[model samples]
Target: MKRLLLVALLLFKWMTYAQTNLIKNGGFEAELSYWRGNDIATISPYDKKTGKNGCTINQYVGEQWKGIDQIIPLPKNTIALELSGWVKSDGVEKGKNEWNTGKFDIEFLSSGEKGIQNESIAAVVGTTPWTFYQKRVYVPDGASKLRIMLALGQTNGTLFFDDIKAIPITQEQLNKFQEEENTKRMAAIEPSKESKVTLFTNGDFENGNTAWRGNASTSNTVTKEGKAALMIQSSTFDWNGIDQIADVPEKATTITISGWLKSEKIQQGKDTWNNGLLNVAFAGNDNQKTGDDQNISFVTGTTDWTFYTKTFPLPSGTKKYRIMVALGFATGTLYADAINVTFN
Candidate 1:
């Protein structure tokens, strides 16, 4: 009986080893021996969550774009692949490119031709604690190689990566994992009906741009009534804006939108193309333009904190409305606070 049990244990070990980890030196245990990139190096800073050494890009001063990547040949009969790792950051910010947020990317090549590409499931930003990120992709026919990349583009910060792994997985397993994740996320954000009634969830900016979407950021430089406010700074005639969508209360007839805005060195360029202005607009559920578009043009020059209000009748068939505040096509800084939308 003892010899039979020993044989079974040996077979189980072989089976586990057969499920290979395609990535080499994934933990940076060998200290950058297998990774390649400019300004990429292995760091001795052990991750608290994983308790392992991590790889970092541009750990020292002198902010510049940097990345690390590894290319591995794919084995035969592979169906799908999953890449996962832990990432920690400090003071990471977005760059000129919309996808500039520090992230990991995976690319598959077939006969030296690109086939599949994807980035981390979510953007890594601000001072984040050690968090796990993952991406999964189907292996296309004739795929020959896979490239794994960790990148930071035009952003200032320190990013540490650890315990990276790439392995083959079944499509059913990937779908099960994604469904579990979505269910967890939905449960976490489930709020009471009273909380859902408000149109703008983070209008006060107290939650630090939680529901607002835009190229802007949250800052403590100026606040009408909170610890933080939305700040938008532009160096060119680019329209930087923030917006949110709120559900229209049933039987609502009118909606009123109000907010406080301030600007600094706002310039109205030589032509309409360069004009800078603060604009607020409301759109219907189908994203069609509504009659609620309002603007306070920076053509009037710099302005102190001012209150703006606009009321409009809810258009027929409008199930929800989107509110957008933007610093339109100019160079300047704009601060906004206490945005509120109400229904009668």
Candidate 2:
């Protein structure tokens, strides 16, 4: 029995190792070996909720870029990347500049680790519990590397960080990262034209129910490229459809929601519930709706494939974004595909 248990334990460890992603030492389980740190950053032992050590930074001196840095190499055909981590703070205060705050900064690099361009960071400030932060970006056409810096830029605070993750976006994910200009602009836009990033999990349905859950079933019969869930509603208030909850970066600016929709035999929902529509609700870390839901209504009755794009302000303290391609309380069959959410 002892030998059997030992084998089981080893198998579990191997399984975990096989799942390791692009971000090295992501959970800080191995201390600070994989990172280069300055004087203000050190390892916080065994305080993380995951039972792993976390990297902590003390920003007292207002000017030193004193923190940690890690460089990630990218493979060819990598179109975008996803970043996420957990942050805890105590008595944090912003610096003189708007960009100076406790946060993660990403700067793209070319071959031989040369600088390409710096991406905007979502500032982390104030006292807070363990908060999850995430960002997604489009990779430059010829870029080859990424530098992730964890620092309290010009901000005075104590921050603890763990579970840093950086994942190269898949082809399916890139399908959802469309291009968008300002909210009022009306013109043809291409995703590759602007900042290449995302906070929304790619719901392009190309991966077939990868990051989505709920009653709707994945179907390829009527998809853009023969993919997406077969959206149907069995009853009202049951929220019968596919939905996804994704993490958003703190202090992110404009949020653009874009997707494709197809409807058939749709009817008015009970009371004033919109029939076939895309409903987005902002939520906190607990996954409970914290504000009223917003909608991009779909035309009633049958319609061919129609694309939609909506841009709105990122609500304050929005930790989780709830996206629903719901039928509301209406009886209908619709298909929602390639739903992409991006933030500036």
Q: lDDT (CA) for every model shown?
A: 0.65, 0.65
Pairs with steric clashes in candidate 1: none
lDDT, candidate 1, residue 229?
86
Question: How accurate locally is residue 237 in candidate 2, as Cα lDDT from 0 to 100?
Answer: 22
Counting clashing residue pairs in each candidate, in order, gives 0, 7
Per-residue lDDT tens digits for candidate 1, residues 20-60, read 77888888877777788734654665543455567776434
- In model 1, the runs with Cα more than 4 Å from the true position are 1-19, 48-52, 59-63, 113-116, 170-344
CA shift of 87, model 2, Å: 0.7
TM per candidate comes to 0.43, 0.47
- Quickly count the clashes in candidate 1: 0
Q: Which clashing pairs does model 2 show? A: 136-197, 136-198, 137-196, 137-197, 138-196, 138-197, 179-191
Name the lDDT value of residue 27 in candidate 2.
81
